[model samples]
Target: MGYIILSIPVFFLLIGAELLWSAWTHRKVYTFPDLIANIGCGIGSQVVGAFTKAAIFGVYLWTYDHLRVFTLPANVLIWVITFLLVDLGYYWFHRLSHEVNFLWAAHIVHHQSEEYNLSVALRQSWWQGLFSFWFYLPIAVLGVHPVVILTVGALNTLYQFWIHTRAIGRMGWLEHVFNTPSHHRVHHGSDPKYLDRNHAGSLIIWDKLFGTFQPEEEEPVYGITTPLRSWDPVWANFHYWADLVALARRCTALGDKVRVFLKPPGWRPADLGGRERPKEHDRTNYLKYSTDAGANARRYVLVQFFLLLAVTSLFLFKQDSLPIWGAWVLAGIIVLWVMGLGLVLEGRRGALTLEAVRVLLFTGAGIAVWMSVLGWSWWCAVIIFLGAASMIHLTALSGEGEVAGQ
Candidate 1:
C-alpha cells in the first residue's frame, strides 16, 4: 500500500499521457465522469486499506515467525525466487477472485470501469487487500522472510500498473513471457472469449501454463458482463455483494443460498435459471454509461474531488500517527466525500443534499480543531472556507444540475 501511494503521481502522469493521446488521435478513450469514478474507486480503496492493512500484514509476519521450515537467507537469487512466488500467489488470488462469487464481490470494482486506461490499474477493490494476504501466507510459511514477501509483493503490484492501457500495442516477444498490455486488455474484456483469461500480475507464463491465456484476436469490449451504469464509487464496491445477497434471498433451498456466494457469478439456481453462458458482446457501436451533467455541476465535482484526493493522501500518510479511531473517522469523511462526488457526477437529484451534509461535517471538523487550539489554525480556517465556498457553488448550480438531470 505504501508503494502504491508513492506511485500515485506516476500513475496520474501516465493517465494524463493516455488522455493526450486519445485527444490527439480522437479515439474517445475517456469520458470525464468515468475518469473521476475510476480514480475515486482507487482513492476509496487506498483509504479503506489503510485502516486494515497493518493487521493483515501482521498475520503474514506471524506466519513467518512461527511456521518456517528452514531459515532462508535474503540473497539475490532468493529475491528472484520470492518475486516469482509472490506473483504466483497474486495470480491464484486474482484467478480465484474471478471464479468464486464472494471473492468477485470484493474484486469486481476494478473491472467495473467501461474504459481501460492507466487509471483502470488504480481502480481497485477496497476490501481486496484483506483477502489477498491469506494467499501469501504460504510463502511466509516456506521460510521466506517477511521483508522479502512484502517488498516483492509491492513490486508485483507496481509492475502491473502500466499494463492497464490501450495506448500501447502488443510488445512482440515480451508478450510471450510477461503480462503485457495486450494480455491485460483481454483480462478486462467482457467478450465471451476473454471473460476469465490472462490472470497474471507481472508474468504471463502462469496463464499460458494453466491454459487461461487468450491472445488478442479482435478489439475486446471492456467491463463486466453487466454494465454498472453508475458513477457512485460506494455502489461500485458493494453492488455485486448486494446482488449476491439478493439472489441468495430469492433462493428457496439452503444449499442454493450458500452456492450463491461459492459459485461463479451469474450462476443462478436451477429454478432461478442456472449458469449464464457469456453471450457474444461485440465491440461495434458499444456505448459506455455516462451522464449529461451541467457545466457547473461538472466543475464542482471536479474541484471537490481533487480536494478529496488531497485529504485522502494526507490521511494515508498520517494514519499511523493518529489514533485508530481518528484514522477511521478521517476515512469515513473521505469515503462520504467520494460518494457525494460520484452522485453529483451522475446528475442524481439528491446529490446536493449529500454534499450539504458533507459540508456540515467538514465545518464541524474545522470547528473542533479551532476550539482545540482556542484560536485559529490555518488548515482549519481553510477547511471552513472551502466548505462555505462549496455550498455557495452548489447553490449557484442547483438549477443547472436539475436541468441536466431532466
Candidate 2:
C-alpha cells in the first residue's frame, strides 16, 4: 500500500500526459464515466487492502518461519532469483485468474473497461489481494526476506502500469522479451484469438514458454465478452461472484453446483448448456458503456472525484498514525464517496439524493478528523465550501432532468 501511495503522484502525472497525448492526436481514448470508474476502483482496492493486507501477508510470514529449506542472502544474485520467482508466480496466478471461475470474479474488474488507456490499468479489484497472496508464498518460503519480496513485487507491479497504454506501438526487440504495451494490449483484448493470452507480469517470456502467448496482428476489441454495462465500482468487483452464486443455486446436482465455481469462466452445466464460448463481435461496431449526463452533472462528478482522491491520499498517508477505528471510519467514508460519484455519473434513479447525503456525511466526518490536528479551522472551511458547492450543483441538476434508471 505504501508503494501505491507513493506512486499516486506519478500515476496522475502519467495519466495527465496520456490525456494530453490522446487529445493532441485526436484519438479520444477516454470517457469521463470510464475514468471515474477506473480511478474509483483503484482507490477502493487500496481502501479494502488497508485492513486485509496485513493478514494476507501474515500467511506468508508463517510460511517463511516454518517451512524454509534455504536462507538466501540479501545480495543482487538473491534479488534476481526472487524477482524471477515472483514473476513466475504472477504468471501462473494471472493465468489461473482467467482460467478458473472464482479467481476470475476478482480479476475481471481490471478488464471491464471497453476503452484501453492508462486509467484502465488502475481499474483493479478490491478483493484480489485476498486471493493473490497465496501464489507468491513460495518466494517467502525460499528464505527471501518478506521485505525484499514486497519491494521487488512493488517494482514488478510498477513496471506493468506503463504497458496499459494504447499510445505506444510495439517496441522492436523488447516486445519479444518483455511485456510491452503491444503484448499487454493483446492480453486486455477480448477477441477470439486473444482471450487468456499473454499472462505475464514483468516479463513476456513466461507466456511464450508456457504456450499462452499470442501476437497482436489485427486490431483487437477491448472488454469482456459479457459487457458489465454499468459504472458502479463496487458492483464491478463482485457482480461475477453474484452471477456464479445465482447459477449455483439453479443447479440441482451437487457436483454441478461445485463446478460452477471451480470450472473456467463461461462454463455451464451440461443440463443447462455445454461450455459457453466467447462470442464474436465486429471490432468496428463496439459500443462503450455510457449514460446520458448533462454538462453540469459531468463537471460535478469530475470535481467530486478529485476531492475524494485528495481525501484518499491523506488517509493513506496518515493511516499508520491514526487509530484503528478512525482509519476504518475514514475508509467507510471514502468507499461511500466513491460509490456515490459512480452513481451520479451513471444517472441512477435517486442518485442526486444519494450524493447529497454522501456530501453531508463526508463533510461531517472529515471535519471531525481534522479537528484533532492543527489548521483545523481552515480545513473545516474548505470542506464546508466544497460540500456546499456540491449540494448546490446537485440541487440545480435535480430540477433540470430525471436520472435514468440502470
- Index of the highest-TM-score prediction: 2
TM-score for each model:
0.96, 0.96
As a whole number from 0 to 100, the lDDT of residue 292 in candidate 1 is: 79
**Candidate 1, residue 106: how far the Cα is off, in Å:** 0.9
**Residue by residue across 159-197, what tens digits does model 1's lDDT show?**
999998888998989998999999999999999899999
TM-score of 2: 0.96
Instruction: Give candidate 1's error at residue 70 in angstroms.
Output: 1.2
Q: Which one is best on lDDT?
A: 2
lDDT of 2 at 109: 98
| RMSD to the hidden true structure, all candidates | 1.8, 1.5
**In model 2, what is the error at residue 230, expressed in angstroms?**
0.7
C-alpha lDDT (0 to 100) for residue 318 of candidate 1: 65
Error of 1 at 147 (Å): 1.8
lDDT of 2 at 297: 81
Cα lDDT tens digits for candidate 2, 215-288: 99876788999999888898898899999999999888999999999999989988888799888887577677
